[model samples]
Target: MTQCHEDRVTGALSVTGNAGGLFHLRDGAVIAVESAGSPGVETLLLSSGGISAEDWDAALVESVGTGSLQAALVARGSIGLAEVEAVAVAALQDGAFAVAAGDVQECVVVSDSADVPLLPVTGGVAPALLLAETAGRLDAIASLPVPLSPYRDRVVPGRATKSMSGERREIVAHATGRRSARDIAFATGRSLHSVTVEISRMLGEELLEIAPPATAFSFSHWGLPSLRPRAPGQSSGKEMDWTTTPWPPNCGRSERTSPE
Candidate 1:
């Protein structure tokens, strides 16, 4: 990114790794970015009711030839210029966060503008400013007691506590040991960064815990056996019956706990 800014280039930075994304730049300034691991502009717009599905589809059809959905939406009055810009900017920043949080192996500059698909959202943001903000977020996550990967690390509700409310409460409600932070973000229509950071705090608070992956169990010749691990500090020489890990005390409260 520094090299692109230095050269004052125009095009997209194609990145490939654990989670791939595209950074669309114009004159070395980032105009837009799209991360596959996070929700994009369309999802944000439609999910947040910024634009109706019918209207969005209409604008998409109208923009088929021009490849400019922004222009099409503005012309059709489906969305105002200010609103589109705001949503686009939010999506761009969230996309940048998603890419940074993942494992990126390589990034190459694609000099051809035709190869870039994302449209310009804001006037443009300097690569340095964007990188600085992204780094700050990553650093904050790293400083947490339990750093998390938005795309991995399924979480389950831990000890019951009345302290959680609002968005944090909603996050706990969705943390059913099935969805990762990314999946929770998509399910809740929130940013992946927000969900990840909240989960990290909850983990630190002992309100959430990393869930073990669910796998099939094989029955021994005698009968089905427990799948729980031996108690900590127990010597390997000791022979005992392993019991099932108990659920959190509040897991069965009178609430709809089915995961989405």
Candidate 2:
């Protein structure tokens, strides 16, 4: 992501799945972002009392055929400059993380002419900077030890959070296995990143357990066997010793010598 954006590369990166993201970049900077897991900035603004739904609609009306909705909001004194910038940056970060949550193998990048209409950017961010911040956020979550490390893996409270209090306890109490971190954030008025990190920590502390994410359709899921870890003392899965390993039931070893 940093490389694509840093070289001022023009294109879009699409994570090829339901929980994926589409990021449009221009000349090494992120211009527009959309994510499946995270809601738009408007949701956060309304939830945080930063803006009202009616006012947002009015701003949309004001910007009809004009310019950026964010710009219109600022111009109309609907929100301050700093707040608008903050919201935009946060939303972008959220989208980036949401895309990242997908398995890295599933993500694919393609370059092309920048002709597609992108969501009007509230602000642009350098890809390197955006990626760095997102990595740090994920790191905060990953520092905690847990059985499941995948982002889309849901979690449920496994043990009582009786020993915890405040936000931590509140978060664990609400882990019903049906909600993703983003959903919990909306329900609890917490930031998505914070909730993700917190859930990771609680899981490490044995206050939570892993659950499968909502099932989705994919040939990989149904037909493809997932990668498994190498057996004990094995150097690598690719270097399997088929000769010494158990046979596929009654298969005989080859008696023929190597062909001269």
Candidate 3:
């Protein structure tokens, strides 16, 4: 990444390993990043109610294969460019954290012809700034009494409790011995970094525990309900009912340490 920044390259860096990511750089500055271990910008926007399902579908249609869904959304006034940019930034930071938290075996540079990000940070962000923040998040997680990998360890509810509320409560509600922190993030429409860190702290509180190897889980999306996030330009053919999203009523567009 440092080398790419120095060279002022505008292209995509495809990283492959335990967890992988695609970093989009424009003029040497990172505009966006995508990682399977973390929710994408599309998920963030839809899950946060920053845009509606119909709005996303319309944008996808308008952009077609142009890879300019961001422009389409803005053109229609369905959402502001700044709002989408905020979500893109959140996705970028969390994507970086997800890739770093795992093992990275290789990163190959692809030409600028690679499809543009559905949404990108306007003016972009310095790679150094992103790396610094990701490092800080990792350091905070390392400081936990029991640092846990969001993707590797399946967790189950611990010490029965009824008082948990907000995100933590939702997390516990989904810790059914069949899911990892990553799964919970997908189910809750939250950033993987936040979910992983919260789960690590909860382990210390005895509110969660590692699932035994012998634990039998259905594995069908773990038989747990999902937030059913729809990727941009990819539709389910059926409109999603998103009125019951689990986001806290107070959740807003502010940039969180690990925005979801």
Candidate 4:
């Protein structure tokens, strides 16, 4: 696969209108497009076959007829099913074309041009396809009205901030072992930037320790000793020897006995 760095600010893939090209995101994630195409005119999404990135690109170009739907994929890399769903919902709300693919669900196609939903595959579609579809839908729907009015003005809304913090905590709790930044981001509902920033802050403050590969930190390995109480009246110099005295009435005890 031909790998090249895209702009970090936009998180977009830089590619010419050609076949067999790869785009690397700012988070060190790489996506190889099977071919180059426009956004809304052609099939924007292509399934990434279990092959080399170069082969994947060539297959996509051959399948889609031309390079009309490649820009969208370059903009957005492969996304999860949940993220695809979110994009689809947003796209449908705005009266635009949207597509979705899931591990268990078939490929979904929703568009203003089509009356019925289209399913390319029966069983499931790959993540790369889903991401491409989402990007295409987003591009098609960009002109429509999005229901982001309430969130458009806030620096960081209260609910969003709280949710982010909770997600971070959950990520940290489950980050017992050495996991990649991308994996943590995928697990914790956070972005790659957010995960990296939080990890850096934690490491600098000595609150978290990083282990390479599969190493993990266990709670039981902290080496703190357990505490236990001493027996009553075990000292000889103590004056309070009331163990023989009668217990309080109705104190759930019929009699009292010494330690012997």
Count of clashes, each model:
0, 3, 0, 8
lDDT of 3 by residue, 1-260 (tens): 98889999899888998679988999889998889889998888888987888988988998986668889988878688788888889999999998998889998988664567777888888999999999999898888789787788989888856567688989988988778888899889899988998998889888889998756254322232234544443433232244344343322222334323
Q: Model 1 clash pairs?
A: none
Model 2: per-residue Cα lDDT over 40-90, one tens digit each: 677767776877788888888887677567767777676787887777667
* By TM-score: ranked, best first: 3, 1, 2, 4
| TM-score for candidate 4 | 0.25
Which whole-number lDDT from 0 to 100 does residue 23 have in model 2? 79
Candidate 1: residue 66 Cα off by (Å):
4.4
How many clashing pairs in candidate 3? 0
Deviation from native of the Cα of residue 54 in model 2, angstroms: 1.5
Candidate 1 lDDT (Cα, whole model)? 0.79
- Which of the two candidates, 1 or 4, achieves a greater lDDT against the reference? 1
Clashing pairs in 4: 34-57, 36-67, 37-67, 37-68, 37-69, 37-70, 38-68, 38-69
Deviation of model 1 at 128, angstroms: 0.9
- The CA lDDT of each predicted structure is 0.79, 0.66, 0.82, 0.31
> Mind sharing the TM-score for model 1?
0.74
TM-score of each: 0.74, 0.64, 0.78, 0.25
Model 4 over residues 143-236: C-alpha lDDT tens digits? 3332111101111111222233565566666554545443454455333333444555554444445553224322323332322322454323
In candidate 1, what are the lDDT values of residues 1-260, reduced to their tens digit? Answer: 98998888899898897667899988888888888777888888887787889988888898888888889888877678999898888888888989999999998899885865444775678999999998998898888778887888998888857686778888888888878898888878778787888899888888888887761122234222334443654423222234333432212123333442
| Better-scoring candidate (lDDT), 2 or 3 | 3
Candidate whose TM-score is highest: 3
